[model samples]
Target: GRRALVAGVADDNGFGFAIAKALAAAGASVCVATWPPALNIFLNLIERGKIDDSRRLADGSLMTFERIYPLDATFDTLADAPEEIRTNKRYAERGDFSIEGLATQLVADFGEKPLDIVVHSLANGPEVKKPLLEVSRHGYLAAVSASAYSMVSMVQRLGPLLRPGGSFSSLTYMASERVIPGYGGGMSSAKAALESDTRTLAFEAGRKFGARVNVISAGPYASRAASAIGI
Candidate 1:
C-alpha cells in the first residue's frame, strides 16, 4: 500500500483531514502531523468520538491515521527551536517536531523511501485581521515562515525519503494573486510565494528526486483558520 503524510491537520474541518480520508479510501496508510499546542485538543476530539462521522471512508470503513506527530513548521530543526518552545508543556515531551526531525523519525520508523505522498495543508497568520499596511514586520515574517517557506523546508528535508514518482502538494488561495480584504498579515504574500515556489520546486525536486511538486489555489471556505480572517 502507498503511504501518505499530511502536515497541519488540527481539525476535521480542514483540507488536511479530507486528504487523509481520501488517501485512506485509496488504500494508503496515512499519518498526520498537528501543531503541538493543538495536538491535545485534536486528540481529545477524536478520542471522544467528536469527529467520528468525518472519519468515514467511501468504502464505509472508518479512516484511521497510522500515526500522529507533533509538528511546529516554523522551525526546521530542534536546534532552531527556542528554549521556551522546547520547554512548553505541549512540546516538552512530544519529541522533535521540526521538519528535519519529522524526516528522521519517518525514516527510522518505516525505513528509506517510505512515503508516496506528502501534503502541506498548513497556514497561519497572526495578524490576519489587520490590514497589510498595519501588520508588523514580525507578523509579516512569521506569516511567510509558517505559511510559505515551511513547504520548501519540508521538501528539502523529506524529498530523499520519498519514493520515486512520489508527489508533494500544498494549498494556496486566490488571495495569492488578488487582494482579499481582511486577509492581511502578509498571508496573501505568503500564498503567492508558495505558488511561485511550487513551479521552481517541481523542476528542482523532479530533476533531483524523480518526484513532483504542486499546489492547489483553492476557493475560500470557512474553516476554523479562515474564519479568523472574517471571510
Candidate 2:
C-alpha cells in the first residue's frame, strides 16, 4: 500500500486537508504535517466536530485521513536553531514540531521506511499586504523562506526518506508569471523562484534519487493562508 505525507495543512478548509482526504479515499494511508502553531487548533476543530469528515466529494465519495503531524520548517533540527528562534513567543507555543522533530517521529514510528508520496502545500507571506518597494529585507526573506525555499529544504531533508520512483508535488500560483497588484511584498518573486526551483529539483532529484518532482499552478481559491494576504 502507498503512504503519503502532506505538508502545510492549517485546517480542513485548506487544500492540504482536501488532498489528504483524497489520498485516503484512494486507500492510501495519509499523514499530514500541519504548521506547528496551528496544529492544536486543527485538532480542536476535528475533535469538536467543527468540520465534517464524512462529507461527500464531487464524485460522491467520503473523505478520511490517517494521522496529522506537527511541522515547522524554519529549523531543520532543534540543535541547529538559535535560542531566540526557539524562545520566540509564537514558536515556543508549538513545542518541538520542527522539521527535525517530525523526521524523528516519522522514523521512530515507521522505522526508516521510505514514503511513497510527498505533497508540499505550505506557503506564507508575512508582509504580503505591503508593496515590494516598501517590504523589509526580513519580510522578503521570510516570504521566500516559507513559500519557496521550504520546498527545496524539504526535498533536501526528506528526499532520502522517499523510496525510488516516489513522486513529489507542490502547489504554486499564477502570481509567479503575472502581476497581481495587491499581491505585493516579495511574494510574487517567491512564487517565481518556487516554479524555477521546482524544475531544477525535478531534474536533480529525479536523476539522483530516481524520484519525480512536479508543481501545480492552481487557480485562485480563498484558502485560510490566501485570505491572510487578502487575495
Candidate 3:
C-alpha cells in the first residue's frame, strides 16, 4: 500500500501529527508535508531527540515518518507567492513546495495515484485575535484562502494523485456553527467554507475519482494549532 500524505504537521502536538500517528498505528505508512520555514526546525527536533512524549502509542514505542516533504498550502503555485517569501533562506532548498508542487513532486517520486489518504490539518488566521468588526478585508480573505480554499485546491490537484477509494479529510472547529467569543477574524466563516466545500467535494470527487472528502470538527485541545485563538 502507498503512504498517506499528512499535510500541515509542524510538530508532534498538533492534530495533524496526532492524525498521522493514529494512521501509522492502524498499519498505514505515513508521510508528512510540512511548511518549508518550519521543516528544518521540525527536522532538528526529531534529530536532536527532543521529541514530545505525547506522541507515544499505546504499546509505548514511538512512531516514525516514512518521508517528509516541504509544503506550503497557502499558495497553489510558486508564481503566486510573494518575491520576499520565494527568496527566503528557509525556502531556498525547496523548489515549488506549494500544494500544486506537492502533487507534482509526489508523481515524480511515487508515480500516479500514490496516496490513499490526505489529512489537511492546515489553518491560519493572521488576525485571529481581532474581532470581526476590527478585521481587515485582507485578513478575512487570507483566513478563507488558507483554511478553506486550500482544501478545495488540494482536492482538485490530488484528484489524479489519490488512489481509488482514497479519502481526504480536514480539521474544522465548532466556531463554524455557534460563534465562540474569541474565535474572531473571520475564522468562523473560513470553517464554514471548509465544511461546505467538504460536502461538495465528496460528491464531486467521489463521482469522478472514486474518492471521498470530509472535515472533522474537532473540539479544543492543547495542540499548538488551537493556541492561535489567543486563549
Best by lDDT: 1
**Quick one: best TM-score, which candidate?**
1
Give the C-alpha miss distance for residue 24 in model 2, angstroms. Answer: 1.2
Q: How close is each model in CA RMSD to the real structure?
A: 0.9, 2.4, 1.4
Write candidate 1's Cα lDDT for 1-231 as tens digits.
899999989999888998898899889999999999999999999999999899987677788889898899999999999999999999998999999899989999899988999999998999888889999999999999999999999999999999978999999988889888878999999999999999999999999889899999887777889777665
Instruction: Write one digit per residue (lDDT tens) for candidate 3, span 109-176.
Output: 88887899999988889898898889999999999998999999999998888887799999999888
Query: What TM-score does candidate 2 reach?
Result: 0.90
Model 2 scores what on Cα lDDT? 0.81
Tens digits of per-residue lDDT, candidate 2, 57-94, equal 65676555566777777667777668987787756776
Model 3 misplaced regions, further than 4 Å: 52-55, 59-61
Ranking by lDDT: 1, 3, 2
Worst 10-residue stretch by lDDT in candidate 1?
A: 222-231
List runs of model 2 lying over 4 Å from the truth.
53-64, 88-95
Q: Between candidates 1 and 3, name the one with more favorable lDDT.
A: 1
Q: lDDT, candidate 1, residue 42?
A: 98
- lDDT for model 1: 0.92
Each model's lDDT comes to 0.92, 0.81, 0.88
Model 1, 21: alpha-carbon shift in Å?
1.0
